[model samples]
Target: MALFVGLTGGIASGKSTVARLLSARNIPVIDTDLISRELVEPGQPCLNELCQHFGPEILNEDGHLNRKTLREKIFTDSSARAVLETILHPQIRRIAKERAEQSATQAPYVLVVVPLLADPKVQPHYQWLDYVVGVRATPAIQKARLLERPGIDPPLADQMISAQSSDRERDAIVNEWIVNTGDLTTLARQVDQCHHKLLMLTAERTSSE
Candidate 1:
C-alpha cells in the first residue's frame, strides 16, 4: 500500500513550492486545489449548482467560473463560505481520494496538498493520512508573500492568512515541519532532507508488508 502524506500550511507559506520540488524529484503529489478547480469547470455539475445558488454573476463573460467574484463573496461572507464548502468539499474529497488511489499504484508514497487541512470540514476526510508535513513561515513572511499576489490587498491578505490554522496549531498536528523563513535554496535543502526521510519511511513500510 502507498503511504499517504499530507502537505499543508497557512496562506503563502510555500506548500506549493515544496510540492513542486517533490514533483520534480518524481514523487507523486496530489494537489486538491487543482482538483477543486476542475470540479467547477465550465460545464461541470458543481458549476451549475453554484450558478443556481450564487447567480449568473458568478460566471464571467466567457461563461467560465468567475473565481474572483466567488472569492470575494466567500471571504467577506461567512455563510456564503460555509454554503460553498458544503457543495464543493465532498466532491473534492471524492475526487482527491480517487486520484490518490490511482497515484498509489504508481508510487510507494503520495503527497496530498491541501491548503485547509486544519479546517473542521476538511480535517475529517483526511484523518486516514499516514503522516502530515506542515510548511511554516513567520507571520511577516506570510503577509509579505501574500501581498505580492495579484488582487490581494493588505486586508484580504491578512484575512486569508488568518483564516487558516495558526503556525502553532499546524505544528502540533504535523508529523514533520519545514520552516521556510529563508530563500529558495534554503527551502530546497529542507525539502530534500524531508524527501529523504520520507523515502526511508516508505522503504521500511514496504519491507514490513
Candidate 2:
C-alpha cells in the first residue's frame, strides 16, 4: 500500500540531491537514469537494439556504449533521439516500476526519480504514480551546473538543456515543485518540508487502504 512518488526535473536540476536526502531518511528511491545505464551495459538487449540502429561505431573498442558519440548524435538530431527513446524508455520504465514495487515492501512510500516524466510519450506509462514532484531550477542555474561537468562546453550544455522539457512545462504537471536555485541549505530545507508532507500523505493513504 505504499505511495509511489515520481520525482522528476530538467537535466542538472538537482533531482539526485533530493533523492539522496530522501534516501537518508529511510525512504526508498529508484532512479530511472541508473536503470537506463544498466539496461545498456555490454550484453543487455537494449544495447543490442541500439547497436542495430546506431551501428557498431556507437560502441567503444571494449564493446561498451560510446556515450559521447551517442550523446552527440541524439542531442544534435531530434529524430535520432526519438528513435533511441523509443528503444529504451519502455524497458527503463518497466524496470523502474519493478524496482519501486520491490521497494514498497521496505518503505512507507517509494520515490522513482524519472528525468522525462514530462515527456508526452513517457508520461502516459507512469499513470501508476500517486504523486509527481518536480525538482526545478532557473535556466541560468541549470546551464551553470551543466557547465561544471567535465568536457561540457557552454554550447553543449545549452543544447542539452534545450533538449529537455522546460521548467514551466514540468511545473505545470507536478503536484509539488522543489526550487533548487539557491544554496544546499535552502534545498535541504525544502526537501525536509516535502518529506514531512509526503509522510503525512502516506499515512493517510495507508489508513484508507
Q: Which window of ten consecutive residues has the lowest lDDT sum in model 2?
A: 164-173
Which stretches in model 2 have alpha-carbon errors above 4 Å? none
lDDT, each prediction: 0.89, 0.92
TM-score of each: 0.96, 0.97
Decoy 2 TM-score against native:
0.97
**Tens-digit per-residue lDDT, 1-209, candidate 2:** 88999999999999999999999999999999999999999999999999999999999999999898899889999999999999999888889999999999998899999999898878899999999999998889899998888878898888999999887888767999999988999999999999999989999988888
Model 1: runs farther than 4 Å from truth?
none
Query: lDDT for model 2, on a 0 to 1 scale?
Result: 0.92
lDDT of 1 by residue, 1-209 (tens): 78899999988889999999999998898998998899899999989999998999999999899887898888888899888998998998888888888899887789999889887667888987899999999889999998888888899887777777797777666899999999999999999999999989999998898
Alpha-carbon deviation at 89 in model 2, angstroms: 0.9
